[model samples]
Target: MKKAAIFDMDGTLVANSPVHIRAFEIFCARYGVTDWREKLANGFGMGNDDIMRLVMPEEVIREKGLAALADEKEAIYREIYAPDIRPVEGLKELLERLRAAGIPCAVGSSGCKANVDFVLDSCAIRPYFDAAISGDMVSRCKPDPEIYLTAAAALGVSPADCVIFEDARAGFEAARRAGAGRIVALTTTLPREELEREPQADRIIDSFADIDDIGALLA
Candidate 1:
C-alpha cells in the first residue's frame, strides 16, 4: 500500500490560528461587520470563501465590494502574522520520522498557496514536505475533501492509504470524505468533547508533542 500522511497547515502545523482570528476581527471591523469574533468561533475550521459567505450576505457583499475586502483582510493577516510564523512543536521530528520511513507527506490546507508558502518558508520547514495542495487549488476546500484528495494525488498516494493530521472539525470531515485510512486529530481549536464527536478521527492529541509514539499510531 502507498503510505503517506497529509497535514493541515494553520493550527495543525503552525502557531497562527489565534493570529488569524485576531486579524479576522480587525478585518471585519473595517467593514462595520460586528460579531466577527463569534462568527470566527462558529466557523472554526471553515475556508475563506465559506467565512465570507457567512459574514456577509450575498446582496450586501455585492454592494460593498466584499471580494476586495477579503483580499485586504488576507493582506493584513499575512503582513501581521507571516513574519512570526513557525512550526508546532515536534513537527520537525514527525517529518523526519516520516522521511526516514520513506513515507511521503503532503500539506493539505484550507489556506491559499501563498499563505502556505510564506509560513513554511518562514519556518524553514518547506524542505520537509513532499508536496502541498491548498484550498485555492481545488474546486472546494475542507469539509469537501477536494484539497486532501489533491494532496494525495500530488504525492502519488492512494487516499485509502493516507494518514491525515488535522486540527479542526472541517479537516477531520474532509479527511474522512477523502477516504483517509487513518486520521490524527489535534485538539488545537476544538475542545475534547467536540473532537471526540468527530467519528472520522482515529486518534486525538493535544499537539504533536503530546503524541507518545506517532509512528506506532500511524501503523
Candidate 2:
C-alpha cells in the first residue's frame, strides 16, 4: 500500500514556462527562425529533441546535430532561468506536507536531465524528491505512459497508488494511460477552464495552496 506523488517539473512545480519559451525564442533567433513564439507555444510539453525536430529544419539539425542544438537551447534556458528558479506558489509547502506524511515523491518531467537537475537544484527542492525521471530516460514523451510508469517504479510504488500532478494536457493523458490513482491538474500553465475540459484530470487547482487536504485528495 505504498503511495507516491509524481510531479511535472516545468509548469507544474516551477513557474518557468516563460523562461523556457524565451530560451526557445533566443535559440530560434540565433538560427534565423522567425515565428518561434507560436512554435514554442504549440510545442510545449514535448521533449527537447521533439521540439527541436519541430522547429529546426532538417539541414539545421544535421549541421548542429540534434544533441548539440538541444544542449545549447537547454544551456540558454538554464542561464535564463537560474536566477528565477523558485517553485510554483505553494509547491514547497505541498512537498513538505507529502514528505511529512511519508508519501514518497518523484519528479517526472519532459525536460532533459540537465534541465531537471538545474530546476530542482536551483529551487533547492532536490532533497525532497525520492526519484527523478526526465525525458532522456524515456523514448516516448508525454501522452505516453512511459515516464509516469518509470517514475512509479523508481519510487517503489504501484501506478495504481500514485497521484500525478501535471499542468499540461499531454501529461494528464499520460497519467491516465499509466492508470495512476489520481491526476491533479495545475493551472499554472493552462487556465482552469482549459484544464477542466480534460477528462483525465481528477482535480484541478490553481496552486498547491488550494489543495487544503492533500492526504484526503490522495486517498
Candidate 3:
C-alpha cells in the first residue's frame, strides 16, 4: 500500500518559530508582560492558548483571554515574517518526489487555522497537502495524537501506514502515540542530538534533503 507522509507546519516546513517568538514578545509587551523570551524558549511547539496560560498567571489568563491576543500576535507575525517565508531547503524537492511516487501527504500542526493558512499560503505549499489539520480543529493539541490521527483518517490510510515528520519533542511523542508507520524527527527547532533523545523517531534528520532516498523512510 502507498504510505502517507504527515508533516508539521511551523519550524519543520516554514521556519516560522522565530517569527512566532517575536510576535509573542511584541504582544505581551502591550499587556506589560516582559518575560516572553523565556516563555517562547520552552514553548515553541505548544498551542497559543497553552502558551498564554503558561506565561500569564491564572487570573491574568482568565482576564486577558487568548482569542484577543492571538489575533494581534498573528498579525504581527505575518507582517514581520512575510518577506522571508519559504519552505525549508529540500522540502520542495521532497514534496515533488512524494507527488511523483503517489505518496499521500498531510500537515498536522498545533497552529491555529489562521496561522496555518498564512504559513501555507505564504510558502506556496498549500496545494501539496492533502489535508491540513490545525490545533483549532481538535480538542487537544500535540502530545494527544488526535491531529495526526485526523490526518491519517483524512488520507484514507491506516495510522500504521503513515509516517510523520516532526520537529518538536511533543510532536514526536504525538506521532508515536498516534501509531504511525514511522516517525522521522527533523531537527530544525531543536538540535539533532536533542531530538534524538525522544526515543520515538525511526530516524533523525536535519532536513528532508539529508535523506538519501526520502521514499525509503516509508519502507
Candidate 4:
C-alpha cells in the first residue's frame, strides 16, 4: 500500500502566475498581438502551445513555431520569477511530512521541463521530488491525465495510490481522470467557489497549511 504525492508547479507550488502573466504580456507585445489580454483571460491552466495558438495567428505560429515561442515566453518568465521564487505557505512542511511518512513525491506540471526544473531548483525543493512530468514530456496536457499518470509511473506508484495537488480547473480534471486517491485543489489561481462548483477535486484548500486532515483527504 505505498502511496505518493503529486504536485503541480506554477500556482500550486508557488504563486508565480503574475510573473507568468507578465511574461505572456511581454511576449505578445513583441509579436504585435494587441488582443493578448483577452486571449489570456482563460489561459492560466493551458500549456504554452495552446496559449500561442490562442493569441498568435496561424501564420505566426507557423513562422515562429510552438517550441521556440514557448521557450522565449518561458525564458522571460524565468528571468522575471527567479528573484521572487519561493514556495507557497506550508509547502516545505507538507513535503517533509510526506517524506517522513515514506511517501514518494513527484511533479506533474503543464509547464515546460525547464520551467519545472527552474522552480524546483530555485525553490530548493528538487530533492523532495523523485520525478517530474512536464508539458514537453507529454503529448496531451492537463484535463487529459497524461502528465499525472506519467509522473505517477515515474515515481513507481499507481495513480490510484497518489494524491494529486492542483490549482487550476484543468489540473483538477486531470487528477480526476487519473483516478488519483485524492485530488486536492489549491485556491492559488482559481477561488474555492469556482473549484467547489466543479466535480473534479475531493477537497479544496487555500494553501498547504490548511491540510489538517491529511489522512481524510488521502483516503
Candidate 3 TM-score over all chains jointly: 0.94
TM-score of each: 0.92, 0.96, 0.94, 0.95
Q: Compared with the true structure, what per-residue lDDT tens digits does model 4 show for residues 17-83?
A: 7888799889888988888887776767668888778878889888989889889988999998888
Q: For candidate 1, list the clashing residue pairs, or say none.
A: none
Predicted structure 1: lDDT: 0.81
Q: Which TM-score value belongs to model 4?
A: 0.95
Error of 2 at 63 (Å): 1.1
lDDT per residue for candidate 1 within 82-105, as digits (tens), equals 667778888888888778888888
Minimal lDDT window, size 10, model 1? 64-73
Model 4, residue 137: C-alpha shift (Å): 1.2
Q: How accurate is candidate 3 locally (lDDT)?
A: 0.82
Model 1, position 101, has a per-residue lDDT of: 80
**Candidate 3 wrongly placed segments (more than 4 Å):** none
lDDT of 4 at 18: 80
* Model 4 worst lDDT window (10 residues): 210-219
Full ranking by TM-score: 2, 4, 3, 1
- Cα lDDT, model 3, residue 122: 82
Deviation in angstroms for 155 in model 4?
1.7
Kindly list the per-residue Cα lDDT of model 2 for residues 134-162, writing each as its tens digit: 99999998878999999999998888999
Give me the candidate number with maximum TM-score.
Answer: 2
